[model samples]
Target: MTSLSVLNSALLVLSVALVLLHVSATRAKPNKARTLFAIFCGSIAFLMCKQLSAASIGPYQFLIGIGASATCNAYWLFSRVFFRRRDAIKPQHLYVAVAIALLVAMNQIYMFLKGMAVFTPAPDALVRYILVELTLLLSSCILVLTFWEGCRGFGKDTFEGKAQRILFLSVFVFALAGSKIAKGLLADNPQALEYIISAITLLVMVSTQILLMWRYTNHLDFLTTIPLRERLQPSAATDATKATDSRGELSPLARQIRDLIIGQAQYLQENLKVSDIARELDAPEYLISKAIRTELGAANFNQYVNTLRIAHAQTLLADPDHLKTSILAIGLDSGFASVGPFTRAFKTKTGLTPSEYRQNLQAK
Candidate 1:
């Protein structure tokens, strides 16, 4: 191998080894999701090293194909863990995996039998490359969606959310790497594409490994402090049940509540009330009232709303955008009934008022 190849191989090998060690060490843990994530990282590393070598391209192509397929397969498993899917990996999910694997196998066989370049494209390069990019891109999106879905209904506040966020972010960066691969195939820019893809893959690998180690070794579980008992109030359970069926399927209302809380976390500063949410949702006021009290463990209705609003305002106050927006406006928008409540809540939650939080964020 040339100097450049040797250097690249060394980097790839080191990265893979580090990630593999973490994955192997964590395999005995009870967290299946973490284990699967480790496996996913190992697979990605294998593909990265294979692609870097470009020796005959067949191994590279096969690894890439399996990696793409595995990325999607991992999503179902992730969702199952996130949602506590009782059925485990269902037959349909397996069927989908089998289908993707079959495609990868067929693509690899055709490339090998036809004496085609594994990494390089022929006249049909555009079509082939597009398929590759789409497969990986779609798989990354699926994983992200699973994480997003899991964030609802007391999901975002847990270790799962943090893990999901990190994993999804890594997957997104990796998708960028795959996109570079496709770009290289489509255009004549070989060296630029190779370097870009390699760098991105390296970044993704490092981030993913760190996350795996932190989650497994540190036993870090985000949002685990929130009590499950408080989250299971009857009214909330009814709402939850409404959101999920007797079969524990996700209800539309459940999804709506998750979207409302998680997506508009920033908007909580508007001093939102249960009645306001009910009006906004077009659901009955009693149901919303019951849901919050039961699901959230709020001693009083107003406190419940302020909790989210205050948290959001704290984030804004700590953001660079605080320079553009006033503390009072942020308070009001965060659903604070008045300046006093906002200030008190902000201080209590963050040990700083809105103004102070913003100052700190800017300083950082």
Candidate 2:
């Protein structure tokens, strides 16, 4: 095999392993973000395998195009799941991905039936133009979403935040590099550039996997690059096996969680994330999330954290000594990022703006 094919084969092997590992690992479960990430990674593996066997299997350019489309859809879905809580990979998401793949396939299927061969340029081919434009459009959207997630998550100190930054970097590199590769293929110039792009892709993927493991291990504090399945997964002995009755009654775990947040006031930490709390309790992030949502009456992690902040602010406002404190100061002290978000959250919880709530407090 050529050196390029050898490289492709190596990457293909690694990507396949990643897919299998991600799928079988129970620890990553109950986390839709991780599942979508696996899908994203798996799509990369498919493309790599296709490239590694391109000589024998033919370019299968249309199938490759479908894989590209699937990657885009997976990235978009992962982005949504990463940033939003309680959200999931909706059926429509799968439908859209399937639809895109079918559309691309149909274009090629028609050409093949008409006696057109693969990798032969039909400069005026409407199918080719349409596919190229679609690729560019998806690249643009992915770039936008990556940047959006990056900016919003900048300065986050939690594990999930670190993962977000890693994701942003990977996607940014992918989009930047993928755009160039798209252009090269679309123009059919410098075929060697495709090989180079594939190499770059290999590096990016490997580095991302390294970073993910590094961050996760560091956050968990005993994990090396490879953690034991039990250490990572924690099995059903955790919250997954807990009965509804066990959760409903303020269980010891639930009470300890409550005291940690309410009594110790961990919510005041501005950079707190569910994963951070999970590490603190030595429990799965989802377990902590479930406890807070089911037993503690939180709609989600953010809502739970924000409610605590607002409640703390209310307590501070009601203190006679703190009436002299400005609402902004109270908001900041309450762990809100700024006055605007604080005011909005305050109103959301109390049905009155900060200033109005303070005035009513004064009147009382």
Candidate 3:
């Protein structure tokens, strides 16, 4: 086998190994993120196998080609599941992915038939051109959407979460997109140059896998999702207390955070951010985040802040004096940017809508 083939084979093995690792981890933790990540890894393996079988024509090659065509879709779905705080992969997501895969597969089959002289058409045939262009257009759109997903709510993410997002966008998204564009531009280049490009792309993939493994082992929270309520429950509080002392006193930094947000009511400031609190306290953002996680039993800075905001809103919602106050007014006074997120966060925390909570309070 040629050197490019050998490298492709090695990458295929590594990609399959990653799939197995994610699968095993999912079995242990029952995480949707890990399962979707495993699917993404499986798609990468299929792409490598498709490249390895480029010279062969058979049913296996056709199936590999179809799987390879779904790589962008798989990555997009994985990104949505991983980075979006509340979004999950719905049935429509799968339907769209499958539809795109079928379109790309049909385009590939058309090209294969034309190459075999089974059908002849003009080089500029409208039908063939449209199919090819549509395939590329959809793939490009999906890649852009994936990048957007990684960037959504970036400012609110913890420091480690931000780093993981940057790593994924840089290594996986940019590398793969750049390689595809370069391959198209250099289609007529020397075979050796193509092999060199392939080698670099595979090396980037290896780097991505290594970084992901490191993050998985050392910072698993960045890769997994835990419910906000679970993070804030009494059990988590007990664990945090145990980490500190028998007295269950808050750490010094945690005390300062509480003093500012609770005592000073800084959470009443709209668009409150960890960086703003860090600046106020003259501390680093990561340190502030760590204090909240370890001492306050919050999943992140936003959750901690939202918990405070919701609690404050609950007081207003339960007060007969504030009965004249609209829910929007109360949400604004409680520091929410708008009523939508305020309502959502309130519901997640209190298990009732703001209106429902108020109605229940009045009924009591």
Candidate 4:
């Protein structure tokens, strides 16, 4: 039989490798979330080393400079970076990340100092239990905050899809936490039971990593070039369901919205609003919402606008007549605030830098 400690060590090692694999794959020009995720993975690896060692044959309850709060914050920050738009990852986000992790680190450091200063003869068991509970509460609160924002920001009207996924995660997390609490109630049981619980924790962590990767690839990373309307509306559906109004052959409302934005260059406005569009068209807010999101199949308004900007930039880059135009100028002309975001967005859509794209056009 495999020893629990050895199993934990193996699992932790596997998880570390997976995290490192993702970081390496995206490192050429690492995204903001990718960098933050790397830091989180590194911290978790260090903690796992200490915990696995203590369980198997190392020091007793040694501190590893990271704890529950740090891991929880890492999870939250990863979600933020992964879902937010390319330009959304700003300096303030870095400050916020540092602030959250620093708060937990400071508390731990202060407690460690206090312990050294007031070495009591007898260890306070109740105090330790209370501290554990507080840590769990803090971590749970952070998870709540992360989940709310993460699902909200995911494109494609994700309130139903992504939010449901987060709900599933919440159930899994609480169920695991409950199991631990139940195990603690079995204090009179054999010492080996503790090892079993640790093994379960290791399994849970591995499963979480797998779920995250699967979700990222399956839904978030799965790009589609087809028109959004076709994906949702099956070919076998009746023609009557197509709702052919004056909007156009595709979707009259959707086409109207697109034409107004494209022809008038409304996308050039950085702070465009759904309400504003609705008011201009004298349509109800939900009607316009349905036009863009349900009928058009855009992830959200921002994504729809980004598509226009990226497509426009592509045209400018590929135009032989505009051979002397600077990439930065094209990016700005296409509604991007700066060259960095413009480049990232362009690469994301076309899988090439503006220069490379231009060169390819010339070659063809």
Candidate 5:
């Protein structure tokens, strides 16, 4: 291997290790979506390792080939369940996996009996490559469709459907890498193309590792479930005050409500129920509700709570430090249990999807 290839391969191995560690760590948690995400990471790690080592073709390749095929298929299945997509748990899906695994295992046994270590690259390789690519494309389409549907609802603002987007993007990169590998399998100049494909794939794998870590751990503290650092600095408050103060008329009660909501967010977590805030401030529930209504220009108590949640969620989303975090999980932890309401509030406030907002943050 050339120095560059060695370096790239080493990096790929490191990425695989990181992902595996993340999967192990998250395994104990009963979070279905997160656990599925961990499995997705593991599958990618296995695929990358196979590419790096160049699976011995034939029986070994056959086994590895089946694993590789199943890994990609599993990713789509996992995504459906993770994203709450329907028909994910149907009998047909389970049967398909079992049938594929059986066939692949049978092929491996047959080749081994023939005293072959690897199967020769036969006409089947072409058919398998096309099928795998088509499957990946189908998965991509499903992801895109889910994201689009999620966007149509207010839930897009919350971290709800963003997983689909991230998963799709990761899959897209993998598919592109697979395309290069497929080309190598079919055409001349396989060696150089293999290295280039490996390099690009290494980049994608590294990005996936970073995102998985960020989503599951507080490696970047700013991406923590609870807001730790102050966002919308105190100066932002002063600005809001400045605008209101210029009129030489500030409603003390309304100002108090605003300060309480914004201040509680800055320090304490999202435990501020309207009644709790009302009791702490020694105000009537109705009066406190009135103050929030008039001051924040929002309707009802739940809307007020969601406003605060969305505000905090935005702060996390906007933070350059949290670009890797899961927007949906962040939304949930931010106190918006559902993505629809979160996305609506987010779009209403920021006029962009969580992914778009993150992209904008990255652009900056």
Candidate 6:
């Protein structure tokens, strides 16, 4: 094998290993991020195998070709599943993936038939050109979407979360997109240049997987939002004791702030802000934020308030008396400005939509 083929072989092995690792790790827990990550890795593996032998023709190669073509789509979905707290993989997302896959498959089948001399196109035919442009357009849009997803909610993320987001945008989004643009611009370059570009791209991908594995093994919570139980149940104390213990963890000013919020149920105000809390407590806004972050272990004032709101919403969700109450009304009563943020936050914490959680309660 040539040196390029040997490098591709090594990358293929590494990519396949990462896929297996992600799949094995998620087998017992069924983590959506890890599962999607496995698919992303599999897509990389397919690309590497394609590079090793570009002219392979068979049913299996056709399927693998489709997968290699959907690399951008797979990474886009993986980014959404990784970064977004809400329902990331909606029905529309699946439809788009299927559509992209089908488009690529059609192009591949066209090429296969032409190569076998079973089909021919007119000299003026635009079918091939149109299909190629459409695929490129869709892939570019998906890349842009992936970057947007990585940027979304960045201001609200924890320090670790922000770092992970930045890392992904730098390593995967920019690197892959740059490689594609370079390849397109250099379409007539020698085959060796293509191999060099592919090697660099594969190296970047392998490095990303290594970093992700390190993050996963280190129990980094950046990949997902904090669970509701961890946010609420910090210890084994009873509710009354828990209240006292929670207050005890804070400084005197923080305790006073907590008392003012909890004692008067200020969290139900819906438009509550740190400035409002600071004004009521005769304290500075920065101090109030610091108290929440340091004493409450929250990423910010909003997270602290949302934790309380989600806890309250959980109570109302499980209440038999409020079984007939509208979810929107319950969410509003719990201090959410609107249903969208409320639903997203609730799902991030609890891994269930408001409706699903309520339904589960009813089932129980």
Alpha-carbon local distance difference test for all models: 0.53, 0.59, 0.67, 0.57, 0.52, 0.67
Indicate which candidate wins on TM-score: 6
Poorest 10 consecutive residues of model 4 by lDDT?
A: 223-232
TM-scores of the models, in the given order?
Answer: 0.44, 0.50, 0.54, 0.45, 0.43, 0.56
lDDT by residue for model 4 (236-326), tens: 2223224332224455566557644553345655556787677656788787777766655465777777777776676567666568888
Q: Which stretches of candidate 1 lie over 4 Å from their true place?
A: 1-14, 56-69, 79-88, 116-167, 170-187, 213-364
* Alpha carbon deviation, residue 298, candidate 4 (Å): 18
* Model 6 vs truth, CA RMSD: 16.3
Write the number of the candidate with greater lDDT, choosing between 2 and 3: 3
Ranking by TM-score: 6, 3, 2, 4, 1, 5
Superposed Cα deviation of residue 132, candidate 3 (Å) = 1.2
| Cα shift from native, residue 358, model 5 (Å) | 22
Give candidate 1's TM-score.
0.44
TM-score of the candidate numbered 4?
Answer: 0.45
lDDT of 3 by residue, 256-319 (tens): 7865565434666788789888876789999999998877667788987898777668767876
User: How many collisions per candidate?
Assistant: 15, 0, 0, 3, 14, 0
Q: Over the stretch 17-83, how does candidate 5's per-residue lDDT look in tens digits?
A: 4566476555532233345445555555655554544434433544443344344445445444433
Q: Superposing all C-alpha atoms, what RMSD in Å does each candidate have to the true structure?
A: 12.5, 11.7, 14.4, 17.6, 13.8, 16.3
Model 3 regions lying over 4 Å from their true place: 1-26, 56-60, 112-118, 121-125, 172-181, 184-190, 196-217, 220-364
lDDT of 1 by residue, 152-193 (tens): 433223233345465755575466557756695847755556
Q: How many angstroms is residue 349 displaced in model 2 relative to the true structure, after the best TM-score fit? A: 20
Clashing pairs in 2: none
Rate residue 209 of model 3 by lDDT. Answer: 54
